[model samples]
Target chain A: MDTAVLAGEIMQRSGAETYRVEDTMSHIMRKSHATRIETSAFTTMLLVSLQEEGRQPLTVVRRVHKRGMNLDRIVHVNEISRKLCGDSLSLEEAYAELKAIEQESQKLYRPITYQAATLLTVIGFAVFFGGTWLDIIGGGIVGAVLVGINLLGKKLRFNNVFQDISASIGIALMGIILKQYVFWNMNLETVIISGIMPLVPGIAITNAVRDTLMGDYLSGAARILEAFMQAAAVAVGIGVGIVIASALIGEKVLL
Target chain B: MILKIIGVFIAIVAYSVIIETPRRFLWLSGLVSAVGGAVFVVCNEAWRMDMVLASFWSALGIALLSHIFARAFRAPVTLFLVAGILPTVPGAGMYRTVYYLILGDASMSSFYLTQTLEVAGVIALAIFLMDSVSRIFLKRDVGTQPWTKERNMDKKQEEK
Candidate 1:
């Protein structure tokens, strides 16, 4: 098709702003046909396109800004001429749409809570280590508490990774105390699992393996590398604990 | 039975909450997890009953079920894997191997390597069998295979 028609089609399909419609079209034109677009403009346009394609947005966002000039001021004289002749979206509908958009964005931005994670991890460890049913159940309860505290910490805008690491260490100390003071042979597995459960990259490693087997060489390698890095992070935490415990107590105190 | 079911429930709840799935589909996921755990329980008992036959049958069963779940859920294969594979993941086995290393129990590195390979082989076999059945029966044709001219067109787009 001709350039103008292509521009119009891309604009309609992508929901590109009237002003940016021409620029994005030119960008697409300059790139090879095989090139996949990754620009923010293209991504926004693509999301809009998906909406136009009848896919309901699982989340939505709406933003209004004072750009220091009105649309009528910046718009073309001919566009103003058309606006005088025609009408468009109602203000109320725009506001409603924006509200939905904000809700969607909030959902996407929600971080994983550590409450349920820690409790479940501890319970898993207890049960797997053959702890009594009560001990196992107690571990689950602890995990729930950890998840709750984690969520609260996030809501309070606390440090992200630091909160996580501290909570994990806190849970570990609880386990150690219970073992040392309460149950002489208490299960450490529950504590360790609960504490480190969130950091395990099990799914990532599994997908990496599956992708490699299926010959998705590029995606596979990328995922596999990510899996190892996450694994290394978990290992480093363990190593650091061991090193610190060794120096302070002069014994293997990180049981 | 109920206790085992509870363990399975815990697994599913833990995975979903940990993975951040919404509450809507969690019940469905829980039921699926319970079923997965029960399957492993049977498989484990059977393996104890007869190692050779049970291993063959269990491997075959897991492959069939895995492919079915992958197609039905339209979820990534990893989800089914995390749920179903856990019962058989040999986490305890790995821990034992780790403990042996920490305690310096014999020249255990080679032994642990063998154990690791055994675990790897089982996983590899399960995946291969699942993929093959998927190709043969379902003919779902994942991977880079070109089933038709139109499908091949998609590859042409991706290759660039």
Candidate 2:
């Protein structure tokens, strides 16, 4: 029971889909002598109950917070559970493995590498959208600035919506500044779109679709709403930046 | 077109880093994403498909590839599926939806909003179909269903 709950907790906090979380937990619990196992996972909480013929029913509930994408951890937990079910690992060994996975999931990438990845992602998007060399350079500069803001925002523990809004505003403002003063022929649209790619909720939207199809209606709807709010925040930020820039320059920029 | 494929590969790899996908599988995931992007571009430009239809085809390819990779690597399908589907996600439409909304152009906003939802719907259908078909054919190996033979063995063991 404990092992199942632990696996579910790790998977939930790591942003596994709700059905997958329930499935994993149930799979782990089935290895025990429990005759009946029931597990249900929501976006914010997980519940597991197991019953044996002669023993008291066991129920565990875990509240999931701080959901983030960590596919590595999900894969690790899946492997550990599979091993446990296959009888290759004892209960203690499985528990220990889960603990190790929890720790490893908390490990952060090097700050420099993370920043560089952000820059590269923007450049890639600019090129994918058929931007010119100048646009790629401009997008990279904007991406670097956005990465700095994100790092700072994480340090300050800013609200997610607020952080997205501010970062997007920075992106749009930089794009306009580069177009007006730095690079005469740079395409502001390509640069701004590329810079904001990292802020988009692509994962959330994909997960939401999967969840709904898997019959987890509650989680699916919640994730869709979350994606909408995030996109709106970014749009508002870009609009604000464009409005401000246009006011300063006394020329309307059609966005 | 080749540059776009390369860009898709780099973008997916960079995203894998952010999502902390296992390092060993990063290259494979990038390849899957690039293939999806290539399909999307072909459907959109070469075949002159609608945006929503193009997204559907791309998502179908990605989900199918993810399932294949999952079976080969003995890993969860979500690892590759989430990253590979990035290119087909309606981020641009979402941006346009909100952009027109803020600009007070309700007609444009509504158009993009519908486009976004339609794209999301088609992507969902593609994934659903892949999952259902895989579950039917690979019922014994996939281990997604609870009533598989392995679970029955546990029940039998408990009975004894």
Q: Which stretches of candidate 1 lie over 4 Å from their true place?
A: A1-103, A108-114, A121-125, A141-174, A190-198, A242-255, B22-24, B42-46, B49-63, B73-79, B82-121, B140-160
- What CAPRI class is candidate 1? incorrect
True contacts kept of each: 0.12, 0.64
The C-alpha stretches of model 2 lying farther than 4 A from their native spots are A105-108, B99-106, B140-159
lDDT score for residue A189 of model 2: 76
**Cα error of candidate 2 at position A179, Å:** 1.4
Mark the 10 consecutive residues where model 2 chain B has the least summed lDDT.
B142-151
Q: How high is the TM-score of chain A in model 2? A: 0.95
lDDT of 1 at B70: 50
On DockQ, the candidate that comes out on top is 2
What is the interface root-mean-square deviation of candidate 2? Answer: 1.9
